[model samples]
Target: MASSTSHQNSLPLPIFSGENYDFWSIKMKTYFMSQDLWDIVDKGFTTTENPSVEQLRQERKEKQRDANALYAIQQAVDDANFSRIMGASTAKEAWDWLKEEFQGTAKVRSIKLQTMRRELENLKMKDSEIIKDYYSRLKGVVNQLRAYGENISETRVVEKILISLTEKYDPVVTAIENSSDISQLSVTELIGSLEAFEKDWVAGMILH
Candidate 1:
């Protein structure tokens, strides 16, 4: 039991620092589940007016679990974030408070999601940007959309990239479209092909 406790403590917790609450909450929930503490944290603990010996023992066990869950949450947040939940007496209360404060209301999330969608639609690869750098920029928006519950498929992402590249890539894009099924191509494969074409293009210019 001592060794088991040590092993559990050795696992790292995702520290929340007010940003990316969606990602942090997902990680924290998985951590709580791994520790077998999510149930108490999610549903909270209840007490009965009158209880038998077994019931009392079970209640004590649950109380201990709740305390453990609360402590884990306290440890997983920074000092600034800690103050937000300082007044919470139960793990469930702390969790819910953080969710409400950071995740915002459903309407706020919908508005934010719409803004992200607009950003994605307007994204384009700059003529001066390398394939990897442009892909990184595109991926950041894609991840934000996904974290906010958008269903963005790889094929959709691939198509978006194909249309967003600068005119210098038109020849390679044409070749790719002609030779391969765009729907079947992975982002990594497309990026690899574009990067190879870019290297040759650069070398040809240097030779001239």
Candidate 2:
């Protein structure tokens, strides 16, 4: 039972392909942290010349941890991505090499982020689209923007949804705006309210 519980605690590392570098990196970092290997990956181990007995023991332990970290990274990437970091001797080297190859330069990230921002701004709930589908589309754009370091607040997202909804939702939107504190309304709560309103609206139309 204990062994089964321990096995369950070990999460499978997320495999990295050529795309979604931001999400993959985040997941990898978290995985490394869970295994207590992030320190070696983030800041590599250093060897001391003519070390004392205790220092030598610590060095051996660190070296083993470093090897484990590197092996974890190697296993987490696909064939193409693994090739990019094949020459890396340390976990930090592998991590940095993959970051440079996939994440691109700061300027490139800035340009991508700008494009995401524009997409978010242009998003609107189509008259025929259901609330669930529209929110999923909006959330995807917001997540990509956030992964690129954009600080989009929940309140801002709530406000965006309120304004971007179609004219058919105007009455519900107005009621929500007038009755509730928009600043405190969570995205989940707003979605629920809108979905409930949609069901009632549809039922009314059917009756008419």
Candidate 3:
């Protein structure tokens, strides 16, 4: 019986081309590789470009520096905005907050060991960047409240006043957008129109 079994035919294994072999090899390669693996490159070498701790640290530092810089810009703008919106009421409260939280771009540019900003020139971030981020933050708050089925806070009541003031500043933006009309209206006339708008809106509010 053992001799008979030894004489039995074995099945023929199919031959694979170099391309097919490469394809299968690649498929297997992915399975055997670690997350950090660059490739099983050159038949198993240093294996991957595992960043050195210092490199990792430098990356982290750069990220934090950028974050701090953007944050500083945002806080500075927000604080200035808060003061403008709060008018006389924001004096003590806003000053303390600013001292604690709002670092100007210049100061952020000066942060030690940071790569965020340097030279007063780079510190001059575009006005569009500030306005974009400001509106984004404002939109985010509105979205959050809507999503949560929540009402705006008293804090946001103040924000509403600021939003109104910001809206009132629109004529200048329009003039800038359409350069021909910049001098068509005096600043006094603009202010007077805004005051009149406030009066009418207030009267409507009372009547309703």
Candidate 4:
């Protein structure tokens, strides 16, 4: 088997941070699955009481996979989180530990929820900010809210846009609400329509 240490040393990105755990988790899981190490982390390797030669070889493969998985995980976390999982004997153990540390606690969830709620409430589309930039900011907050287990619907997001945007967006908002089913509209479509209006508005200004 290839040395897991080599793979660990060449991480494409830096370790995960608490604030970006949701994105980091998805990326890391994809990496593990691509490398075929996720199986060891998902279902531990079992060995027979009296192993045959082939069984021993299989056991060795499982052990190597576990080691590689652990190494990959260690590279994706900070020293503090590393310390929490350092004592884990298998990749599954380390994975479970990290999940619990980051996701299992109500305290963590509450803190994350509070922070996202505050950001959403205060979110505004700045006059200088382009439509794409403004929508990106809103989408980011919504994604974070979902990551923390909040069920934020598209209608709520549309409402946020209507309430938070500047006067320039008011006409677009009115047209959208009056002409379209807000609940049926995806956030992407809403952003695209508003961006089109912004382009027209800019063109009109240039012509004048």
TM-score per candidate, in order? 0.83, 0.86, 0.18, 0.67
The global C-alpha lDDT for each of the candidates, from Candidate 1 onward, is 0.91, 0.89, 0.37, 0.83
TM-score of 3: 0.18
lDDT of 4 by residue, 97-183 (tens): 877777767777788799889999999989899988888899999998887768998889987887888899889988988999888
Give the per-residue lDDT of model 2 (tens digit) for 72-155.
Answer: 889899998899889999999999888877877788877888888999999999988999999999999998887777999999
Off by over 4 Å in 2: 1-10, 47-57
Question: Compared with the true structure, what per-residue lDDT tens digits does model 3 show for residues 101-134?
Answer: 3332445424521332122112222333333344
Clashing pairs in 3: none
Q: Look at candidate 4 and tell me the lDDT of residue 90.
A: 88
Cα-based lDDT at residue 38, candidate 2 = 94
Candidate 2 at 133: error in angstroms? 0.9
Off by more than 4 A, model 1:
1-4, 36-64
Candidate 2 matches the true fold with a TM-score of 0.86
User: lDDT tens digits, residues 1-208, model 1?
Assistant: 4775677689998899889888898788888888888999999989987998999999998888888889889999999999999999999999999987997778988998999999999999998999999999999999988887799999999999999999999999999999999889999999999999999999999999
